[model samples]
Target: MADPMHDAPRASITGRALHVFAFPSLLIAACLTGFLPAAPAFAKKPPPPVLTAAAAAVPDSYSAAAAKEIFAEGGNAVDAAVAIAFTLAVTYPDAGNIGGGGFMTLYVDNKPYFLDYREVAPQGATKEMYLDDKGNVEPDASLVGYRAVGVPGTVDGMWEAQKRFGKLKWKQVLAPAIKYASDGFVVQPWLQKRHDYAARSFAGKTNFDVYFSGLKAGATFRQPELAETLKRIASDGGREFYEGRTADLISTAMYGHGLVSKQDLQRYHAVWRDPLTADWNGYQIVTAPPPSSGGVGLIQLLKMKADLKPAFDGVQLNSVPYIHLVSQMEDRVFADRQQYLGDPDSYKIPVAKLLDDSYLASRAAEVKADAAPGATGVKPGLGDTMPERAQTTHFSVVDQWGNAVSNTYTLNGPFGAGVVVDGAGFLLNDEMDDFVTKPGTTNQFGVTGDEVNTIAPGRRPLSSMAPTILLKDGNVALVIGTPGGSRIFTTIFQVMTDLFDFGMAPQDALAAMRFHHQLIPPTTIFYEPYAPITGDLADALKAKGYKLEGQPFNGDVQMVRVNGTTPEADSDPRGAGVGAVFPLSPSK
Candidate 1:
């Protein structure tokens, strides 16, 4: 017989033996006909989409596009953030730009750094700047006028960050903003509404006409003058704004507006300070320090909540007990903030005592979880008490090169007091009023600001809109911040809880309508979506003998969260832009 195993024909004695040895004839036939695919099924599944990461833009669409472009150009997170910051300065000038300043917390290469570029009081500033004839604190309107402008440090701050932390050259990073301002940028609905009210202030000025001429409510506005200014800065670096003719022009314009002096401009600098951090459940959060109570106060409140082993699993945010407890903690933190936080260089802060674990434990012990702590139930500082930026914009970026930036910028208010520097086409910030004119007077929050926050010549006032970053095991976990004045810190806190504690996606975390109880108002401000929880919470509070009222509470938060395993960028849906990734990968 020809060898059956070799090239012999199928009808062989040995083939019959082998088939019979392995299986019956029927089984062998089925294996050859149908079950073969399942028999060798060890192929591995393919991986998910290969997108490097995601990004998100908040507020301005143009600025968001600019950030994406920077990432596409091989820029890292820092570079993209710088580009976004500068672009916002031009496109979203009402909230961001060279005219005002803010703070930044960056997590790059497993470490964190704080950049304090908040506005500063001018050299000629006086403690009584916002005081009236009777030594009483003036109304907010009286304080936030032309005379309330400060010596801005935003340009200097961005330049400093770019020079030190940015990967792309200054000119390269600024190209998008220059194009947007010079060529033209369309005003959004919110900007249009704000402009309708502020147009008078812009129109009355001689230089304002040069830029505001073509700006209509809902129409595209061109700021060729601002574009030129940006171009000069891009080419010349910080010198163009701080030491050149443009600086002179800004100073003259400010002086004419009864605000600042040239000396204030010359003396302006962005302070580099250590960011405050608290170790919470193995994660380290870095936020703005003293003179701005955001970080310190937030940490304090978190510590208080931790004491309860707070598992408010089903408790809706707007629930009475939920709002009351959080507000109770908020009040205590604000009290400490008002009493102690200040320009540490100017005064010593008891940060050690204020943030002490035991101290917070004792403070948290004062709360009755099931009961409502009235405004009076919480004493100021000893136990309870209470409280609480600029037109603010925030952005975050992370690159393959391991660079990251979480920055928030601002113009004091929309269009910044509506005063453009003569011929400069840039708005001016009324940031000077951020300082407390009197120790025990009502702040913008309608609550008393602390004495430590009182105004002084050439002092930077405390602010509440803090931008922050968080690190876990030395890797970036979250880059987050917001754009509401007194609500910025509170909004960020809630989102952080959702991300870290609940593991929600950035978009979902931000979109979740929030409630804010500042401890000043015994009531909770509920967003429309939170209405469902209101009745239940109110009844709960009433049963607990707590008084409850309702109001509107809204906030805009934008953030980027990196996945623990793959370093993915998950941008907030509440925003319009995405975090840019270097060496772009296909979208997920």
Candidate 2:
């Protein structure tokens, strides 16, 4: 099989410039050559053709192409999203998997719905599960091995979304993924790098050799076991994986690791809830609710900036003052996240009080224009009651019928738990690491949490996966999300600012340099390696008493911007993904 990474369409400068430069160039050339038409008056040329069938942005080329194919086959946004999710399970294994779980925000018929399929702790789980006999937090207890695995919800989540709004048969949606797993697909560089890293880190612990043996960039990789597993799912629906043989296999494997039991598998269920929404600059922003700190955090950050004028005064987007302001807001929001956000099902979260205008105003009042706030000193707002990886995958889909789906799924950390089920051919999530094992102590990602997010029996771990949809005048305006652990909400927030405030197109918005500040350690700002804010900008920030630390990359956002019936999509340039706008059929 050919490597889709090589064959996928690349974003071109000329293609983007066609609408802005082509017509002007033609008229200029005609006038220069004395061939300008005398009878015909020049009028503005029509804009480029809009993609009418569907526009999809995904974390992998194969998955994006698979979604496009589903749309071509008459599937709606939900159907295309289902196929893309499954295909990512095969192609983007570091994060996408049937063994993990996530949240989805679907917009259909002008109504939005939220689905929470986040992994839950087994019934045997307890607040002290990750603590050592000496009462100290055991690092490995919740970060690796079978004990770290949570009851997965990806299959059920996708199943529910498809069953509710899909226009194609479930089997049809699973077909592409099944073929990719059985027949094999060319290994892309990103997957190959993950394979190499796993081989080194999970040496002797996992069966990396079994599935990814001889894995190399541009080489064909196949997983027949996974193929059979997908076939069973296709034939029996999601029950086979959740309640039947597959579940039994998972239970037996987990039991050997002393993590979960068959009963745990039988009791797992996905929840359907009202999406958290807020009005932002005349647009309705809808996102996943609790169990996801993303929605609330995003809203709070945006709200804080609502009353403030642009820091750079429209001169530069990534100026020192602008970056400092954004970073300050992030520190405050994350402080609130650590202290308050958690699973509303397990705790009483003050969602209403947190979003109150008065509360937000007080929080925003703490910001200083000339100086960066001390991160550790920043405190959460006093609410009546309260309320939250770098490893995850997000995809956005918009179909011809105006239906849209924004989904973000993950296995917690990359190749979570660093262990794959023996026969299941899927990696289990280490979502237990997401809990507040020891308050005040930072997790692997340098993020801290409080009692609100502590572990408990049947409690879902909090996440930073923000699957968001922007609506203007009750119509879908934007579909966007990303996979960046603590950086997810921040990344999406920056992109939104770029599009709405800076007036950038989708591609430029995603391509812009990004930075992240989690607020736990304070004093340090993690910026992308080649981020725009450097040199004089870096010096300016330093003068303001901020420490700038450069990191490899931050987030990979997949987004689609809607203009009436047309949708333009773009995948993050920081990652090796593809964005495709499927051609409209003649009948449409």
Candidate 3:
């Protein structure tokens, strides 16, 4: 495999300072005096190099470049995001997928909207399907083979978002992806490593042989079949992919191995829901809501930290004291997650109560200032209610219209179920593994679950994918998200603190080392290797009775900061990606 940084194009960093364009004094006065009916919409203009209006950060350099092209062609954030989503399918097969599904958060005209397109359990799914005759959980039932798949929703979700907010034609937005798939792209070291890891699982699968045969590091990999499929989708719209020949091909393959049927494909629809918002340090944080535990869990963690303020103030960042305090709070919030968060459509979640200020204050009171709390018996904070993979991709986009998008999608595990449909040219998702086979049991990521996220027909599994936006004065300030199994939320939380509390730039924030402590098995603190929390910091944390393990890598985060009107972007250095900015003029 070729090294990602060595093989991929370097990101162009723009040094432009951001400045917000002010409304004319007369227009503001007229609106205030009721002289004008309403405020006029801001007209779209080409972004100037001095004031960047569009920026994108994707896990794959090709995808980022494609998204920037869409923006340069006068598309809005939604259009650019859709282009990124499709292009990723061609370039980053590990997680970028149409056969899997996830979530999206979009900000347009000062309003935030969420789209839940996470894959759903097939109609034939049952809570006990993964259990054996003795009622013991079948280890492989939900992790591998045909039985692991769920009905996919990516196509539906992308179509719905574009239909509502896209400025370019669907066909135009899809052209770049099709071209990449047909002409091929260079494989980076990261992708080669992914292929090596997934190779064993693909053994004896004919479709895998057809698409991945002879793949090598630094070599060109083309998918003419996928290109043809994209052509059909572009010409006929999503209907061709969902209910026409593509659906027929997928149904035929799935029915032979898994439980999905033609009806499942035809019935899938993307749902639009209100985003969850919380106030933090005078800024409003907005993200995906329930069925996804990311937003609520993040808010609860932030509130807990806010309540225990002076504790963090005295302790240096990434120090033993700071790591211990944050880990303690994480345990409490995650306890709440396992106890309450779930799909609201299947069962009601107490989102309002969990985020209540009073309840958070009570939870914060439990934090110990000097010592590490024992992991054994910590329980959820007292509240009346409530309520949620590592294989995923996240991209952040901001366009010339002040519209922004944060999208995170996944295949559940690396290469998903590792099964490709006979002629579909895509892999199926093992998202069913995301659900608990039995109460108190841990899934692939070692995260436990309860009834709230049990497998049921048509139910969307709980997810850690948290596509998020930060707003200041009702305008987008930041667009961020990441891909890492159970570590997604913690990664985002750390990045937020880096930007808001420590005041680091987006690039520096993403580059900083991070740690995670999921409350389920609370004894260990997972820290990224070579991060600041090493040597003395590591020793100090261990002395506090917590096990510290160094992870080679954590989450792959991609972010965009709207410094006033200028958009600045960065992709995690750990992955093969680029943060490309589109200039106002083509000549630049």
Candidate 4:
């Protein structure tokens, strides 16, 4: 048999008609018959471990390096976080920097602290300030005018946090931003998108041509002006940005462009707010409270879920009850937000009563198990709030020394106010509209504007910046936050559950599918990553009497988690982020 097979194989088709025909036919038959083990079905090789070492970082390279260096230099998480913030101001500008204002949350030695460095209204602002001749509110025009800008407080907040929780000196922490701004930094893809968004606002403005040209994709833009500003802050501290030469320039620029007055700049102040907290399986999760609705709204939603314990206990992620419960809870939270939440300073918002378990339980009873909620359905008493129609940014840092920082920043709408301070190379925040422009008028999040959020002289605008921290056994367990105006609460909520409850790694948690609902639109927005389960969820939600709209994943979340020994960091891949660990060592 072997001799016969070998002799047959030795035959070659070389010119003879029959031999050539037979050889060609045999080749064709072989191809068609598929006798060969079609590209051996082999198991896909696993991808190389991204979190190769115990220490990890989120995506942004500059930010990752910034955090790493701070930790390497003996700074704890707070110091590194502060350093990363300054570095982000230089590296990521569309978000809040010294020029803009927002909020920060700190977890230090098992305690939670919130810093409210939100912008303040001008001296002359009033409820009807944005009203036109016909008494119609002009939010766009108002936001574009100097009157739209509020007193910036981000610098003060950052410095104040450093004073209390940071280990490294302010200058040492800010040195990275100054160098990046002075030397130049690569304008990443995300920055390019933001630059383009802000570019139209800067058209025909002074220095527009000089500064924006270099912001094109792949361009290395050097912000020497910002570097100088950082230098001044480094020397004189945050006061320079508020009451010093920088303030004067900012004021002059605003005044020249029909924007805010100098009084607003001098009057800016950052407040230390009492953190709102809720218990989840014995772990204390702390977040920002009003003038931001992040804390209250999150609590309301979580409280609703607390009663539905069985949904979270299951192993498989795709359960009908689980999906329905999460969606309904989200809707209820947004509904409450639209009706009652506002600036606690002006509005008589009974936050204590709102977050009360009994109150939330009553609201949970309103969610009908079988249908989409109507606007009139599921109301949260007298002070429901809505998220502003805006975009924002976020960053998180943890140094080796037990100090951690979570911050969320924004300019309200894109290229806030479309007003730029001449020669300052910074954008002013249009945070004024964060106030309710008119009673009963709808703001970004479809919430009814009321007296509480109505504009007033020297009132800080309401925000949704919810930087959060979680403590386990009296130690920092997680530092997390996101950059999505109305969707902020949902993003953070999901990450918390994913990390603490589900025990997912930071990267896996971040990469997981996400959904957002604010109750205004009465529809759930599902991200693409949820595609696999979309049909099933749709059916499940429908069976529960809910309508849904699948949407692309829209928020960027950066998170850090501690698992016994080594800490881990994961930035959303959907964002222009880079996650890395300290010391750059291999995984354990």
Superposed on all Cα atoms, model 3 deviates from the true structure by an RMSD in Å of 9.8
Superior candidate under lDDT, 1 versus 3: 3
Ranking by TM-score: 3, 2, 1, 4
Please provide, for model 4 over 467-540, each residue's C-alpha lDDT reduced to its tens digit, 9 standing for 90 to 100: 88777776667778887777788778877777656877777877777766666556544544543346666676
Lowest summed lDDT over 10 consecutive residues: which window, candidate 4?
A: 13-22
lDDT accuracy of residue 64 in candidate 2: 81
| Model 1 CA RMSD to the hidden true structure, in angstroms | 18.9
Minimal lDDT window, size 10, model 2: 13-22
lDDT-based ranking, best first? 3, 2, 4, 1
lDDT of 2 at 46: 18
By summed lDDT, the worst window of 10 consecutive residues in model 1 runs over 12-21
Q: lDDT tens string, model 3, 116-193?
A: 888889899999999999999987678677799999889878887887667678998899999999999998777877
Cα lDDT of candidate 1 equals: 0.65
Decide which is better by TM-score, 1 or 4. 1
Taken over the whole model, the C-alpha lDDT of each candidate is 0.65, 0.79, 0.79, 0.66
What are the RMSD figures for all models against the true structure?
18.9, 14.0, 9.8, 22.5
For candidate 3, the TM-score is 0.89
Question: Cα deviation in Å at residue 516, candidate 4?
Answer: 1.6
List the candidates' TM-scores in order: 0.82, 0.88, 0.89, 0.82
Show how many residue pairs clash in every candidate, following the order shown.
13, 5, 7, 37
